[model samples]
Target: MNSTGVVLSAGDWRLVLDPHRGGMVRALTRRGQDILRPMPEGADAPFDSACFPLAPYANRIAGGRFTWEGQAHVLAPNAPGQKHPLHGTAWLGNWSVETGEADRATLLHHHAAGPDWNWAFTLRQHFRLTADGLEARLELTNTDDSAMPAGLGFHPWFTRRGVSAIAFTAKAVWLADAEMLPTVRATADTLGDWKQGAALERPDLVDHCYAGWTGQLRIERGDGDIVLEGEDTPYLHLYVPPGQDFFCAEPQSTMPDAVNREAPAPLLPGETRTVTMRIRSA
Candidate 1:
C-alpha cells in the first residue's frame, strides 16, 4: 500500500488516492482533464482535497451536539473556526492501507468509543477505477457491543471551471439555517428547479440537501458531462459556497444531524451497512 499520491488509471480515467491523507481522493480526471478538483500541493485537510469519505455521519451536527439512545453527546468543534463538528472524524484522520493494487485500492479505519461520540466501529472503503469512470464502496460495521447509529457517504468536490449546470430530481429539500444545518423542509425547487438542470452562474451560496433523490444526477460543465449515481443513497447534498472554485455534490445515506432525528435506527453489534457511489461520462 502506498502512503500518498498513488495514481490508478484505466482507459480514459485516472484517480489519485492518498491513504495517509485521511484516505482522500487527491484527484479524478478523464482524458487528462479534471473531473473533480485536484488537491493542490501543501493543501491543508480533507477540506482541501478533491474528495473524501464521510462515515459515522455526514454534514453538520448542530453545535456539535446530539442525543443517541437517550444519552446526550457533545463533540468539540473540529473544523477551523466552526462552532459545530462538520463531517466525521474519518476525513481528518489517517486511514490504514488494507490493500493497494493497479486499478483498485482498499482502506480501513477503526474508531473506538470516545468523547467524539459513544460508539465504536470499523469503516472499510474500496475504490476501483473503471474503463470509463470510477466506482467506490463503503462498509461500516458497528464493532461495539451496544447498538450504534451511523451514516455512510462520499464527498466529491467537482471543479467549478467551465461548469454550466447541474441536473437532478428530488421530491423534497432540506433548507439550511445560517449555521449551515438543515432547517425547513421544502419542495425540490425551493432553491432551484433542478429537475431540469439548473444553471449555476449566480454568486449566491448554494448549500442545501435534497431528500428523496432519484439516486442519480448529471453535471454539465463546459468540458463535458458526467453522471453520478449512488446505491443506498437517499439524499443528495450540494455545497456551492460563494466565490469558491469548487462545489460539492455529495451522495449520502442520511440527512444532516441524523443522530438527533426521531427514532433513528441503530446498527446492531456485528451488523454492517453498505453504500456505493459511481461516476462516469454521460
Candidate 2:
C-alpha cells in the first residue's frame, strides 16, 4: 500500500492508494466509473489526488500561528499560494505501508516534534473494501511524553463533472474573512440550503466549516447516490472552488481554525483517537 501503492477491490468497487504521496487515494471507482475526481496519470501532487488524510489537526492554524498552553508556535504554510498552514502536516509527508492485503491496508505515518508542529505522534490510516462500499479510518496516537493537540478528518474530492446534489444538516456555518479564517457563525438558513440538498454547481468559491453536524450526508449522482457518514465526528467542512469540476465535503473533528478559537482538548500521552468514515449506496 506504500507508493507503488495497492488497489483494493470488492464487488464493483476499486480503490487505489498512493501511500508515499502523502497517503493519498489515487482513485476510487465503482464499476469503472469514478466516484471521486481521480488523480490523473503521472500526477504526483496530493492536491490532485482522489482523497487524502487530514490529521494531528484538521484545517488551518491562523497565519500558521497559534499559542497552546501559553507558548506561541508557528507552522509554515504547507499549501501553494496559501498563507495559512491548512490541512495539517500529514498531507505533506510520506507514509509507510504497515500492512496490506487484497481488500484492506493500513499505512503508518510518524511525526516528530518540529517547528511545524510540536509533540510527536503516530497516525495510522486504514482502508477497507466492504460489500456496502468503502470504509476509511484514521487513528492517531500521542507518542509525546507530554500532552498534544490532535484532531482527525479526511478530504475527499468527489467527481463533479455532472450534476451532483448534496445534503446534510448543521446548526450553523463559520464564515471567514479574506484569509479564510473564521470571523462569524451564521445560521444555516442563509447558507446553501444544505438541509434540503443542493447541486454542486456554483459560480463562486464556497469554503466554510459547519457546526452541529448530524454525522451523515448524501451525494446524489446520476449513476448512483453516495452516502457518507462519520462516527464521533461533530464538524463538517465544505470546499467548492468556482469553475472547478471537483468538490469536497469533508468530515472533520474540529473547525478549520479551532486552535485559534476553542482549542481542542489535549491528547494525553499514550492516548489514541480514531474516527471512521463510511460510504454506502443510497
Q: How many backbone clashes does candidate 1 have?
A: 0
- TM-score for all models, in order of appearance: 0.96, 0.96
Error of 2 at 57 (Å): 1.3
TM-score of 1: 0.96
- Against the true structure, candidate 1 has what lDDT? 0.86
The worst-scoring run of ten residues by lDDT in candidate 1 lies at: 257-266
RMSD (CA, angstroms), candidate 1: 1.5
lDDT of 2 by residue, 1-282 (tens): 444468899988999999675989999888888888999888989898999999888878888888888888888988889888878888888788899899999989999988878988999999999767899999999999988778789999988864468899999999978888888999975668999998777786888888889999898888888898988788989898888888888999989888878788989999999989887777
**Runs with alpha carbons beyond 4 Å of true place in candidate 1:** 1-4
